[model samples]
Target chain A: MIWDWGFALEILPVLARAAVISIEATLIGFALAASLGLVLAVVRIAVPWTSWTISVLVELIRSTPLLIQIFFLYFVFPKFGVVLDAFTAGVLAIGIHYAAYCSEVYRAGFDNIHRGQWEASIALNLSSWTTFRDIIIPQAIPPIVPALGNYLVALFKETPLLSAIAVMELMQTAKIIGSETFRYTEPITLVGLFFLAMSLVSAALIRSLEGLLNRRTTR
Target chain B: MGIRTLVAMLVIALVVIGALATQESYQVFMPGLLQGAVLTIEIAVLGSLLAIVMGVLAALARMYGPTPLRWLATVYVEIFRGTSALVQLFWLFFVLPQFGVTINAFVVAVLALGLNVGAYGSECVRGAILSVARGQWEACTALNMSRPQMLRRIILPQAFVAMIPPWGNLFIELLKSTALVSLITLSDLAFKAQQMNQNTFKTIPIFTLVLLMYLAMSLVVTIGMRLLERRASLGLARGKAA
Candidate 1:
């Protein structure tokens, strides 16, 4: 049949479970990316000796496709005696791939902070850690929230790549349902709709968050 | 040596050492990976050309067309941009065949990549066009130039310069995305890498080679786009002087 409502209903629960996997992967991966990205940015700034190495590593990650990285982690790491399950492998690949992007965003935010703030912090005898925590990070983070949110949506969409190594996320689940029932219209369409809805909701949330941050800053 | 140069040399030395370690597998995998790399470039170039056309049309429709056309453009951009490109590819590859519409795998790859990038490029096009000075539009109207003449002669040249940098990013994104086409059974770089991995189980060498190929392609795209952007801006500068 062209479009089977019954088949779509039959597969809803399965797809929904897979959707949870997709969402969880996105959230966990994004968390790893955010923290790792911040660390990379900090190292590039704070440790001059290592900055070039960090820059090259980030560029190497950024230049390649996420699919290749996933394949490398999934297939290649086992050769080095690091045998991660598919889920962990997918998360690590996605996390590090996007950490490159998030680091760039963080770098931009840090660059935008005025030099006078650093000078003032130094004048006040604040420890570097206290200065970053009290003065710099608060200023840097608000501006980059929207950019970070965009990556969140991007990461959510990218969770489908996990399927290549057999993680069985939403798109993979949809593909299985399609093959089983020989009905492509329902499950695939539903998957697309689910992505579109989640993206729109996240975009809306990001906009409001940006506005809230801006208002607080202005006040 | 400066720290940057020293670090760069160190990284190169490490890479050369790693390559020496995997030297034997290079002969087995290089030819297939090279062939796949060519296909990846082919897909990226063809897909980018289509995306630029779609982007310009959709951007114009949204910007200056009638309300219905604007609405249609908005819907197209939102739906395509909001969903995963992988889903779009799967839909084209798997779903269309069910409806008695059969497109070859290569064409499906091009269309899906083109459409997804086009949706993003449309926003850049729209933003660049809008960013053109209000006075330019008013000047064209004052001169009694027709809408087409105004767009072709005045607005588009300025907007084109603005669009190039974002278009470059989209082009690179399209190149990276071509790896996804391997899923539909195209013998692109990622697919060849996978095939070689399964055949030899030399995963480290095979994947490292594929990753470097992709990085090399990305560097080519980045350099190529920079040249294009420079040329476009030079033309714009000469136009202003004239």
Candidate 2:
């Protein structure tokens, strides 16, 4: 079939509308992963018993595919008499799946801290809390900002998996439009373009955020 | 809480959720999860094998091939790195159908994943090779080893150990990406979960089991990789390190 600019133009608005859902899911998932990851990292390192449990939890989460995990949360919770909407389930699954990865990132950060930092803390008679907060974390984060930024991009791209469970995210929306018109080209193409554009924007935003954080850390 | 108590609580919660929930009938879900697990492995192993070869070749090309070949490899690496795998998946599956050559979903997935990993693996291979010191190459030359023999006997052995760990991670990612194959009606874990969701209307148990199956497979892969890594690294890891 010849490329149809007319069909593509007509589908742009619908794709744009669906882009909103994808963007929203990414935002909320990012926030959740960020916070939950911190909680996991702190518990794993601070309390020995807590670390043991957290390690198991982290391993369990990390070992599985996020798509399957999303399916689990989407399918299973309803049996416990807690029925989540498709959108809530999708986003929760994505966020929960990613929290595991982010925790590992934070843990990797801590691991990179040389033993000398701990020695300095002891020599200075500083509490572990003060040492970690003031000295160790500051030094650890800069080198890892780029990697962390990469995960955020990964999390954003994964929003499409939410569509499998009927979340009406960009891809799902495009699929519906494609079916209605029998014009898969227009909707799917636009959806791909939308994802490409948004992800590029996200990469730029993360870079700026990394730059700002680095500047603040240096000062 | 103690670690035991915490795990007990989570297990209890999962059990309760599994018990009281009115998920789909077990029969439909059970067979499907098992079959999907098998398919997941098939795609992962085969695709990873493809990726390893392509990755090594691309790495070698960039390091020693003609200028144009090196440039082509570089562009391939950067473009794949810059884009999301999901986009790559869709393009391979959906876009290819428009060209009147609709390969099976499994092949599409294998190709997309292999190509993507190949890009990432090239860097690992290149890095591993670079880490092989000039002294080793010189020693090989002194021993009257040809270029190919030097690579096979001296340089590659050192580089291979370094390649193992990252390749393991990439393999896990490959396994996970295989779930996307369910979208093309491939009867994989994700696909089976979808079918169970459709037939039983019991989303949770079916999916939880599917998730566990994935976790189990991934654990096996991870543990196996670690063991191999330990063995590989035991003697200066004499081969590839990436």
TM-score of the A-chain for all models? 0.96, 0.86
What's the C-alpha lDDT at position A210 in model 1? 93
For the record, the alpha-carbon RMSD of candidate 1 to the native fold, in angstroms, is 3.5
TM-score for chain A as predicted in candidate 1: 0.96
CA displacement after TM-score superposition, residue A141 of candidate 2 (Å): 2.4
Q: What residue pairs clash in candidate 1, if any at all?
A: none
In model 2, the runs with Cα more than 4 Å from the true position are: A116-132, A193-219, B1-28, B137-150, B237-242
Considering only chain B, report the TM-score of model 2. Answer: 0.83
Evaluated at residue B23, the lDDT of candidate 1 is 75
C-alpha positional error of residue A74 in candidate 2 after TM-score superposition, expressed in Å: 1.8
Superposition error at B131 for model 2 (Å):
2.8
Q: If scored against the real structure, what TM-score would every candidate get? A: 0.93, 0.83
- Model 1 per-residue lDDT at B30: 72
> All candidates' lDDT scores?
0.89, 0.78
